[model samples]
Target: MLAGDGKPKHILEVNGLRKTFGGLTAVENLDLRLEYGELRCIIGPNGCGKTTLFNLITGNLKPTAGRVIFEGREITAWPVPEISRLGIYRKFQVPSVFEGLTVYENMRIPYFARMKPSILGRSSVSRNEHQEIMELLERVNLAGQAGELAGNLAHGQKQWLEIGMVLASRPRLMLLDEPTAGMTIAETKITADLVQEISESSNISVMVIEHDLGFVKEVARKITVMYKGSIFREGTYEEIQADKDIHDIYLGRHR
Candidate 1:
């Protein structure tokens, strides 16, 4: 679908998405849309198929039904590597960094991944490439720790490093699964700010699935509430907060 000016209406569209394992349905006839550069949050109770949805979208697992459209093209059953090369990337709840490698070395992995020829065959990092690596480290507040082993970093720092690693790939759309999980309150707030900055400054669209209500309230401009494997409600933060049905199912009076 196109806008009035003829641009694509949404960068992503999931039509009637469904996923089942044996007798259980993880996701059920779900429909979702995301505009270019938009940030959306998905929230639901445990076992509500949040991770399953991410898996299906990223082609880590095949959908039982429906189509996933990206930039106006259908990519319902694309392979994982193909989907990733098309500028769709996902970061899981756990940090997937190379623990024994230095933070700089970890960043080098994805940076080289996007290049035509493998940099692994090269002897040393180019001057320009080194500058780019340092810049990404700075963005994640890890410039000072570039030489430190990733395994030595704190929990929150590891998460940030993983995010920086993904940023190196220069993805157009990012799927973050519980980015702030296991983070302290202060770290969560910092993550919220970083996510907002990434979207505004880099113009990358982001879809996040998080269980942290406080973090969601801080980062989400629009929130999608999922229930029983489908989108139950979608609106601005205030609208979602004021929704009685949402309150009853997910957010209690404490919210």
Candidate 2:
């Protein structure tokens, strides 16, 4: 839906979203809107419902209440594959690449999945598809290692490879859960750069859940702080960092 300014409205919207596991509430009454092509970072302490929110949006878990709207369509409770086909893709905290396959081979999986070739016969990539995969690998900085086994890549490289694989699906919204969980300072910075570049260069909207404050500061255009299953604060990095209450809650100084 276009707003008054004639610009596209939120690419993804979560309204009064809630989730519970028996007696425990994981996410509650959370409302979020991600603008088209925006890069937003979500930060909070452990057990703050960060991953649960992702699960709900990606259809890994059905919400106990509320709705998930993507590009003006309500997708709440849709199956995982159905949501993925609707241009919403997510990367979990762990790198889920195909370790047995070469990097190039891993890239081919999503590309072909999107192509949906005939089920009656085997399919092969045409010249244009091959070029597209190579271009995607280049974007993820994995062109040089395309022939290497995915298992042979370093930790950060594996993460990048998984990201590239997600990108191969041509998603409109990318949910990254701790894309830099285990990375050196340098790799984290590179990841920040890559994410920023992707958001700026493409129409994809990125929502990242991260614990690394430094990484968050580097990449977040806007920050959402989650606490005890709800949004505690939303602002620029500096504004969030300056709020003493946010710090206290994040550090467990005041439970």
Candidate 3:
């Protein structure tokens, strides 16, 4: 879709978005956009409203002001499930997976949710559905661990499994909040590669909130820096890194 300005509409747009809790303003007039198939990173010190922005966009929290637009449609204050149905899905900082279920079983849930079969209908997985699950598992590097219980997987493996589960929902836009948290350097690097591959192959627009500079440098095609509940800067990874003001914010040289 094209906007009135004769530009291609962004996959996601947050215009004058704001959120507040009592006297505290968590997000302040934040405007951001994600182009189709773009991989963008949001980086800021703690309390800079990165996660809060995700919350507002995903309908976990209604904004005090402004709009959340997805695919040129206004979705402000839509319920969480409604937003999710509209093709937005998020992975929280902590890995959320079915610990008691096998990795393959965990992958089935989102597919089932998407399919929404009749209660009286056969619940058996179709041959094509089975193939789809396997392909998704392979993409997340968990095909070998399909039969293993999710809780038994390593922390990084669990994270990957959860990501695969999210992907099975066929989201047009994916929000990953600190996806590499608690991962080692090697795991982090692998995640960067996986995210890039997903973006490239699936044509999914991905917005990531990350605190790790290394991960941001590796994965971010573009970066947005937030400070004091608003955008401080937006640029390429190199440009962001070269900015002394951003450095000062990270180093606590400025509030």
Candidate 4:
């Protein structure tokens, strides 16, 4: 897709991305791009560098060589907070909600995290901000639990709460690492629909790293397969499932 000015419509572009830990290379010479509001899923065997790739893009780790461009600007090596401010948010494999706080209280933290130093207190929040938090909770199906402690939520509910908190920050892109991990089969299906709803209803580009083939098939419109520290293939779910090379990789015929 292109913009009115004829530029590429990609919301993020990663060119020649590489990361190495001393003699071990985790990621090597990778190229990726995502257009605005695209939902892309990545699947690979363990240690194939999926999480490492996410860390590089989110600034948790610096790339040995690469460029991360977001919204048409280079953001490689930017600090985590700065990158987040640029509208990129990452939801890790583990849920990171505020366990001691209520669902409503947890939503307030992201808002405060983005506040300018001059206005960084509870008094700075307006009534509209409170309503916004409630609305965000409602989007995640947590409206009735707004007063409940976050720690007491079911595993799936906690995951949804974290997603809602990320949405509160108004990210342009969201990297979700196995959002359905540890959920029951029913919960996994619900999460898949939730993610699809989020992507279609919001303006955020989404990238998910998931190992569950069933879940991936349910949620991913496009899938990128990684092997031996690089992207091995990219295609639709049917294409990937039928590819002999993918079968070989999974069967341990190819390393």
As for candidate 3, its clashing pairs are none
Q: What would the TM-score be for candidate 2 when compared with the true structure?
A: 0.95
Superior candidate under TM-score, 1 versus 2:
2
Error of 2 at 35 (Å): 0.9
Q: Residue 103 deviation, candidate 4, in Å?
A: 1.3
Across residues 118-164, which tens digit of lDDT does each residue of candidate 3 receive? 64255688898799999999999999999999999999998899899
Model 3: worst 10 consecutive residues (lDDT sum): 114-123
Ranking by TM-score: 2, 3, 1, 4
Candidate 4, lDDT over the whole model: 0.90
Put down candidate 2 lDDT per residue, 111-159, tens digits, no spaces.
6676545652556767887898899999888999999999999999999
Poorest 10 consecutive residues by lDDT, candidate 4: 117-126
The sequence of per-residue lDDT tens digits that candidate 1 reaches over residues 1-255 is 998888789999999999999999999999999999999999987787888888988999999999999998899989999999989998997888999999999999986676677545775888988998899899999999999999999999999998998898888999999999999999999999999999999979999998888988898689988887888899988898888888777644322
**Off by more than 4 A, model 2:** 5-8, 117-123
TM-score of each: 0.95, 0.95, 0.95, 0.94
Query: Per-residue alpha-carbon lDDT of model 4 for 41-107, expressed as tens digits?
Result: 9998888899999999999999999899988889999999899989899898899998999998899
> Between prediction 1 and prediction 4, which has the larger lDDT?
4
Compared with the true structure, the alpha-carbon lDDT of candidate 2 equals 0.91
